[model samples]
Target: MTFQYIAQRFERSGSGSDSFKALFKSAFDLMKEDTANASLYFLIAVAAKSYVRTYEDQAVTEEVAERAKTILCGYNTRVLEALAAEPAARYAIGSGIAYDYEWQVADF
Candidate 1:
């Protein structure tokens, strides 16, 4: 999926960028290995790393960063598998209603 799609879904869920960067990195790793958009993912990875470097609250060690990346990559792989297995429902359900009751509550 494109970064925009992933970003939209992530934002819609009201998640923070700190958490998102990790998942995005994991997704990029997967994409680079299995998809044709490796270059795009690489660019995204660079941007993500830059964002972290600019905004990180405290100093992060290389070891910790690499370990976090590895863990999140595993998580991303499992999520992708589950998504592929159970695709999202495509239909939209809507409801419409017309009020027929009196406005008696206005007498309060």
Candidate 2:
């Protein structure tokens, strides 16, 4: 499925923080289990944390959050950097809010 579909699904049906976390978990699982949208999944993983950090009372545990960070820091720095460099590509990989939030993360 496209990132747009995922975003729409989340907004329409993912009513709470737990639902957001579940979406993140699904993205993480897809990242491990498939290769088609690794960049997209990475974007979702990071955006999930950002969303929780701001609006949600339910935060992703530090361990899971750190693991996601470590994966990016250790293994996918180039992936994130490359995606960040292109505005359109980043948008294509994420929905509006996700694109904005996750693109900010790619700079670091």
Query: Best by TM-score, which number?
Result: 2
Q: Per-candidate TM vs. native?
A: 0.37, 0.45
**Which candidate ranks first by lDDT, i.e. highest?**
2
Candidate 2: regions farther than 4 A off: 1-9, 58-99, 102-108
* lDDT, model 2: 0.52
Identify the runs in model 1 with alpha carbons over 4 angstroms from their true place.
Answer: 1-5, 13-17, 58-108
Model 1 C-alpha lDDT versus the unseen true structure: 0.41
Clashes of 2: 0
The residue-by-residue lDDT of candidate 2 on 1-108, one tens digit each, is 544445455555534456557667766776776565576676666666555655466445656545444433322333344345575665554454344454545422
lDDT of 1 by residue, 10-102 (tens): 434422347546645755765766564443344335444544664467665655555444433433333334334423311010000001001
Model 2 CA lDDT for position 40: 62
